[model samples]
Target: MASSESSLFSMAGDSYSKYEIRRRNPNPTAAALLVIDMQRHFASIAAPILPALRSTVALCRAAGIPVLFTRHRHRSPADYAMLGEWWSGDLILDGTPAAELLPDIGRDPGDRVVEKSTYSAFAGTGLEEALRGMGVEEVIVTGVMTNLCCETSAREAFVRGFRVFFSTDATATSNKDLHEATLKNMAYGFAYLVDCKRLEAALAPKI
Candidate 1:
């Protein structure tokens, strides 16, 4: 599992290196970490990245950047949308254990948690408004299903005028191929790809 996780980071660095630009590091004062869908439903997928994700949360906290989480779930058919049709009853229902965020995640009582019914956290969730109210101009995205929620949120964030930094090691999916593909796509246009190590250096307090 560790090797697989390591390869994801390597591939992300290699694949996105060309697109990296100068001064893209997220400014702590203007940034927030968006931990997406780290719920029990995707526990296996989230397992490998848990340590890195936790580190990411801590790093952001230490840097004085706010950390928020998104939890995806459906209350009924009224909110299911196409996810229900596509997943064929595999949807995460509200109030179920699968819909709950993993307890081990580094979330604090004061941290804001957004609930969404779609892959895009912005969809009907008022996340953008919340971030705006917080004076956040940049977002660091991390969490489960790199090809789905993370990718969708990153693209939406880009179009919504937020500079996005996507975490490679702190996010995961069912397989490495899908994960790396999202990284390539994000690097090509939507966001700057960052791993935990990059985040550490970028967010570390200056001497």
Candidate 2:
């Protein structure tokens, strides 16, 4: 009878472990939408991710959530030191078409625009303060170069104690492998993983 009880306990523990493995995040209370690097140079290359981005933005707008757009802008090699070298002398100078947000997801006066030189949007930008001011507790992150800027921003958000929801279909990278790797890492432990469709549903108005 002791062996039988032990076997039942083991079976129950296995079931509980499996349930834990498949657990999902409780829905976020207040989420800010982060649109990262949807600029001219990267947008065309990130065409696959665009539709999802657009849908997510629209859903967020409809839900009255704040939307923050991040552009990767750098000074010219002659004007800036560290970043110009990092970009191999190419510049994403302010006011250049390359620094402009993609037209499909147009920015409203109410939406915030942030210029960042580094991969992390929160670094060297007012993004953190702005989010805090708006009372944003969760950030829905989406955009180009999944392995670089998007991943970095997501990590920074996590470190800052903001819940991160990374949309898998709304992010891209020049290398497919790198993109997949970032998504896998974020999904495993770094951030909550939701596809655009799921996000849209979450943002939908309840009947």
TM-score of each candidate structure, all chains considered together? 0.91, 0.81
Residue pairs that clash (backbone atoms under 3 angstroms), model 2: none
Best by TM-score: 1
Q: In model 2, which range of ten residues has the least summed lDDT? A: 1-10
Query: Which 10 residues in a row give candidate 1 its minimum summed lDDT?
Result: 1-10
Residues 1-207, model 1: lDDT tens digits = 111122232233234465454337889999999999988888777777888889999999999999999999889889877887887658888998888999989999988999999999998899999999999999999997788899999999999999999987788877667777887788888888788788899988899
CA-only RMSD, every prediction: 4.0, 13.0
User: Candidate 1: global Cα-lDDT?
Assistant: 0.84
Q: Name the candidate that leads on lDDT.
A: 1
Q: Give the Å error, residue 32, model 1.
A: 0.4
Clashes of 1: 0
